[model samples]
Target: MDTSEIIGQSIALENVFRILAKVAPTDTTVLVTGESGTGKELLVRALHKNSPRASKPFVPINCGAIPKELLESELFGHEKGAFTHAIRSRAGRFELADGGTVFLDEIGEMDFSLQVKILRFLQEKEFERIGGSRPHKVDVRVIAATNRDLEKEVDKGNFREDLYYRLNVIPIVLPPLRTRGDDVFLLADYFLKKFCDKCMIKNLKISSKARELMRTYSWPGNVRELENFMERMAILCENQEIMPEDLPDKILSAGGVEQDKMPVMPARFEWPRLRDMDDRKMNLKDFLDKIEEQLLLEALHSAGGIKNQAAEILGIKRTTLIEKLKKKQLG
Candidate 1:
């Protein structure tokens, strides 16, 4: 549902857009490859919407999620008396999506035995229900997506080689967030606006320091992770800006793709000394903040704010420290 929702002006996204432009009007089976949360489904939806089947239903099924026993019935439909629970006849995904598209997510996790059934339908454009003896044909286009390495799966004999080759006819790879240039910040801002509007909340923008922290992180979870973090930060945000201190340590500590891109973690800051603060009444937030602030000041003072040197001395995040300064109004 989100087109052009992708961020990043990097060559990676440029290439992705080029591919999308070429594939939008075709009925070819497209295999989207990337790490989890890399927006594979989003791309697939974009492709379907831009194609001729825009008005048709988009049936999405996670091959790995459905129980193997029920998977066949779910994809190919079943007669009223097909199985134990088949009290009523039902149309499966393939049958219902006759003129539209079927997105098979996590295709790599599909059971090997069931893989054969899918391959057969792909080649013949027809399938039979679990209990029905009649073979039915459909005109649905298939779009398979996964974060798994299918080549390796084929090597390990976990996936059928022919099936793998078939689905990969038009492969589209999505780059990780770390390599998407400034796209991280862009996506964060975009999602922030979208979520706030959906929830009828005030628009909030992430601070410049927060943007820097986001840019520096590697984002192992990719776009999905970024969107998730932004939504949470917006809810917890004090005003109209997302501060670095609001993010979790794990996200802040992540490394970006390029050494020059910046760190994913927040900067360290020096806070009131433990003895100077009320310890007995300190909550988890204050305690962690105290530690972060203290480490940063010590590191900065020890290394005279030479980020590299200070990092080696205190093993704290320079990006994170910079973030703390912004949050504590120390910057």
Candidate 2:
């Protein structure tokens, strides 16, 4: 419900914010394009909220949600006798949003015929009901959005070329969530607190291992998927701190299980300065091997001698970890 709520500080989103700051004052036809769940509609609402038309109606029409036959009526009203059903006269999104903005979401899915009608309204600021004769001129600003590549769609002959040019006066592109660093944890914390409050669940912090697992997994569904994942964790996690065991099955085991094509030494030690022994140079591999052995000892001590849990923290396979333990003969 908050108008200015923006998420993530990725370079792409920062660029988007720069555009939003510049365009929020002017009445421009904006085309918000991005993959689904990237917050296109939120940006549209932000535009409306920031614009001079902030007090006026900001209507949002999903071109894909309404039926093809009804979509025309949804965008441009229908006269009582327009179709066989002969429904009563209606006010369309454009008409209802007169003196304001109308957001056409999923505009790429609009039928070719309706595209021309929309283009006409964009051009003349006027339209007629489906079966009415006189044109009703309305001062309406159009902001459109879609998940499809409209330019590519036009090139493929699936979308209209004229409408493409008409609605795309200003364009904003949003990047997916995976590319956004740190924002993941930021949003995760936000959603976790929000859902916990709403659902009356206790607050929780993600365990260190769980945090590592979350950071490594690829979120294909973007922000939406991450929110859902958080909600599930909030509902299921009973303790004050969420742990790797609390995460859903797929995520809990991700990243740590992948086979290591090259074994990198994992070590922790405090020893006499090797810098003083210049000519006594040992093979770097041997130093790394010794380092790995020392680190294993530290991990065992850190884990209270629990190898399985220690292996989980180190992000290595338990068997490989045990082999390392045996090679070094460290308990």
Candidate 3:
């Protein structure tokens, strides 16, 4: 039941872990609610792994994935000749998960009629197969997850109120990635290392500017999107370090990063020498000063005028940034 797989040190994520630690061993019906791609399935798996029935089958089925017409048979398997497709008897998720856990994913999308059946199982721990007369009992724990708002669905008559209560005995609400603060960077680095290892490439590191951009951008797709982006970088990155130019346009635009300001992506390594500086038609002091001023301005703009963050971006102490600002009459 190692939960190290669930990355994040944010207070929001830590609270989830605390609740999970308390409830994992219990048989209480739990409902995990979160936005899509927020790792609801992963949380459910952690719950099942830490539960008393860890050794037994941990069955999972996407209630929304199966067609509405066949969802019943998928949950509580059909008897032979139950329908045109039911030529042979088969066990359903509940039966297969006996003595373990049944993860009903996207349970909010379940048909109203099917929900009644699920509610019956939660209440009596018994269910009847499609076209079967006998009621079969199962010793299984139910854990349901959904990205939809079940409360609203219940009010709108889309989901049954009683079933919602039954499934929501213990609610675990997962926070979206945008609100997780520095956890974003932690996950970014983690995913970068992970994809690098998978691709058999030396691990790539995110540049300071790139890290700032990532921290600011709203990750609508959450960890799943970040993971995919990291894998893409691992496979496509031309350099060992990921810079602002290497990021996708979506990310740059989302972070309010100016694409023209980013360093150009070069196919090979190049260095700016004294001879290269000759084109600028300036002395070393003035040239260096201009470069320093531009960097300061970019850092301040990136940090949104937050002195501490701007200093960090510039790799200087806050006092140093302040002194420079005053010296340059730009404070």
Candidate 4:
């Protein structure tokens, strides 16, 4: 699988990748648990792509989305006369996924009776088509995912205990985005670039203050929410740079910064300190030079690359600006 699709460098995300690498090769039943919008389906697809069944069909069905009466026919194939709506013989997900995998999304929402059939299939690797006289055997892997906590469901008698154990032979719990530090900015930047490119707009940059607000805001909808917000910004935001005022009210409130009070532009200067030098592991000369280069770049950017204006912004002579640009090889 192209693991690049799963973006994030946080320790929480790295742990999930480690487990996925070890489990993808095996046919052991996997139960993925996570909140909605945490990219459970994406993770499962990656699993199948990395598995031996990569070339085979990867079938998926939402156990909760389908009617209970028809879910049985959906999972196990049905004969023409299996039910009133079974107008003709049809292959279910299990049959269609022969030699590949069947992803049972929202498995926790499955009815108890259907759970037993799933358990039987997991145990025997065979199942009878609805209203059929004999069993059909198929070599297929099963991967189930749910937003609910199966253990809690089992305790509450809403889910079958035996089926829970069977499907959870290998459990992969995805961490929520809120707990993944700094990953918010990483994803925000990626999504912004992607949406901007798709919309054929100039790439937008998030201000450092706006980034701080995003980092502190709890993204309840996870990566999906971030992607949507970026798309909206790409289409709706007029400014090239996303400042504090550009963010939505929820984000501003969460960051405890009022919209009316928020600055339209970032502060021009913040005095550097000894800690900055220590953080960069640079001595006095190199540290000062790095700071000068950053200011020069910011001035040039603000002036739209006009040398006279950039020199004025930095309060330096045009000749000095040219000399600095030449020395830094930034011209």
Clashing pairs in 3: none
Each prediction's Cα lDDT score?
A: 0.81, 0.79, 0.85, 0.86
Candidate 2 local distance difference test against the native: 0.79
Model 1 residue 225 lDDT score: 93
Q: Which stretch of 10 consecutive residues in model 4 shows the poorest summed lDDT?
A: 253-262
Model 1 TM-score, 2 decimals: 0.76
Candidate 4 lDDT, tens digit per residue, 29-99?
99999988888999999999999999999999999999998899889989988888888988888999999
Structural RMSD, model 3: 12.2
Model 3 gets an lDDT of 0.85
TM-score preference between candidates 1 and 4, better one: 4
TM-score per candidate: 0.76, 0.77, 0.77, 0.77
Q: How many angstroms is residue 330 displaced in model 4 relative to the true structure, after the best TM-score fit? A: 33
Task: Enumerate clash totals for all models, in the order shown.
Answer: 17, 1, 0, 0
What stretches of model 3 exceed 4 Å from their correct place? 256-331
Q: How many Å off is the CA of 297 in candidate 2?
A: 22
Model 1, residue 157: C-alpha shift (Å): 1.1
When summed lDDT is taken over every stretch of 10 residues in candidate 2, the lowest stretch is 253-262
Indicate the residue-level lDDT of 151 in model 4: 99
For model 3, residues 1-331, the per-residue Cα lDDT tens digits are 4798899999999999998998998999999999888889999999999988899999999988999997888789989998898999988888999999999999998988888888889889999999899999999999999999999998999999999998888999999997899999999999989888887899789888788778767777888889899889999998878886687755643443343545675889776578757888888987787677667766776776677998998889999988986665444
Error of 1 at 24 (Å): 1.8
